[model samples]
Target: MFCDLIRGAAEVSICYEDATAIAFLDIQPVNPGHVLVVPREHYEVLQDIPKAVGAHLYQVATKLIPLVQTASNATDMNIVVNSGAAAGQNVMHYHIHLIPRKEGDGFDVPLPFPGSVMPNRQQLDAMAARIGSMLRDPLQNDGMKLG
Candidate 1:
């Protein structure tokens, strides 16, 4: 049953595999070199994923980050998951999204612009600076300083 599921995977350009987990390309990708990391055993979503399976899947996903960046020539990437129908999950199989991102991809996965209220250049720059500063020391003001 599990073998069949893995076999049915189409448009997969597998970069890594193991006894328990496998990482492959996403057929209907939002961007180039988008990949899916999945466990060999079938699971509907994050809540159903076994602890061992989840651990191995995450390990493989972490290891593939650098590879994805190098292969796709991207400066950054997004690791995402849509668990259910409400969350936009079309597939029953549990998987992780490894999307390689460039400067301008026309698809904003993190931020969305609803309506016509767009921020001016100054506002945008201020927002960017705030985010950058927070990112530099995320735990500082949050009372959880990093070492």
Candidate 2:
């Protein structure tokens, strides 16, 4: 279904396709020749994806990076993933962004804040330590095993 939507769209120029993945242009692109690399499976997010599928997706992306750069004539690019709704993921299917960037492209990624109050480094470290301890404790028994 997802592949159909991508392939059917007129705006997206397909750069590559394989059994496991497809690379196509982004309709609402951040830059010229912005591409979306998606797995053939319909997994919603990275955490839900099986390791083998995830590896395949990464391999596809790696293979297409140079092709996208050459085709778009871009010196550099940004690869991004928005895993959930809160993270600006409009689609439920898993996809990786490949945005071609050039000098003075008149694009600016929004930062969280302009020199806003930042979290204390020491406090963050302490919180991480506490979380690590809780995660290591067998009593918690959360289904997630961080081996």
Candidate 3:
């Protein structure tokens, strides 16, 4: 699906394109001129994308923000990335939403879990430590394991 869009096989209007990625107007836009930035190469999730390509995707997204705001006459914008199926990512391929915002636009960006309270500092700290450890060693084992 994404490949077709990038190759101009689809009727979607193209907003911008480069060697690494493409930005196109959203068919069902939150506001007029809303856009989606997608990498040329398909990645099922953000973590699956190479760091360089991921960074380029974000760079393209940043470039679109001003264009969307100016074209839609929006006061603000929201760049959203739903990483996984559990995060409301309908498409398997990675894409970033460039939603333009205006006063009383009536588009609400609800939290993943509404009315959730913050945990205590101690609990937060402990969780962060565990996550940090995972980042330092994803398998929870020293970097001795091979593919």
Candidate 4:
């Protein structure tokens, strides 16, 4: 569907659009101005998207923040992107959610790394080391590629 919206095959109330990306209202909006932005090209996983396009997504989201906030009278913003199924990415197509927020809205964005307990400093360092080793080429994460 996002591809359909971008292609004009599916009817969508697009709020913004350009050669590289597009923004539109979410059907199941967390708030009235909740919007979703997506790259013009279809990509399921973050690793598969080019850096330029990924950067463009953030640019578009940043650009939309104030506009959406003003429109919805939102006091805060929740910008989110879930990369994989384990990360809560329901839609395979890559996208970003721009949820408008207000005080006592009764919604809380889940922690990025939710778990039972916090890790100690030593454990944190080990975790960072494990991921830092893969920073050189995140797309090829030693058989951990999402796509």
Choose the strongest candidate by TM-score: 3
Clashes of each: 0, 0, 0, 0
Model 4 regions more than 4 Å off: 110-115, 136-147
lDDT of the candidates, in the order given? 0.81, 0.83, 0.86, 0.90
What TM-score would you give candidate 4 relative to the actual structure?
0.86
Tens digits of per-residue lDDT for model 4, 1-147: 788888889889899999999999999998899999999899998888887899999999999999999999999999988999998999899999999999999889766647659879999999998777786465746545443
Query: Which regions of candidate 3 fall more than 4 Å away from where they truly are?
Result: 111-113, 138-147
Best-matching candidate per lDDT? 4
Point out the higher-scoring one by lDDT: 1 or 4.
4
Q: Candidate 4, clashing residue pairs?
A: none
> What local lDDT score does residue 116 receive in model 4, on the 0 to 100 scale?
54
Relative to the unseen true structure, what is the Cα RMSD of model 4? 4.3
Candidate 3 C-alpha lDDT tens digits along 1-92: 88788777889788888899988888888888789899988898987888789989888888788878998898899888999999999888
Tens digits of per-residue lDDT, candidate 1, 77-139, equal: 899988988888888777899999988887685566365588799999999999778867857
**Residue 36 of model 2, lDDT score:** 90
Candidate 1 segments exceeding 4 Å error? 1-5, 8-11, 111-147
Tell me how far the alpha carbon of residue 16 in candidate 1 is from the true structure, in angstroms, after superposition.
Answer: 0.9
Candidate 1 deviation (Cα RMSD) = 8.3
Question: What does candidate 3 score in Cα RMSD to the true structure?
Answer: 3.8
lDDT per residue for candidate 2 within 50-92, as digits (tens), equals 8888888888888888888898899998889999999888888
- Sorted by TM-score, highest first, which candidate order results? 3, 4, 2, 1
141: Cα error in model 4, Å: 7.6
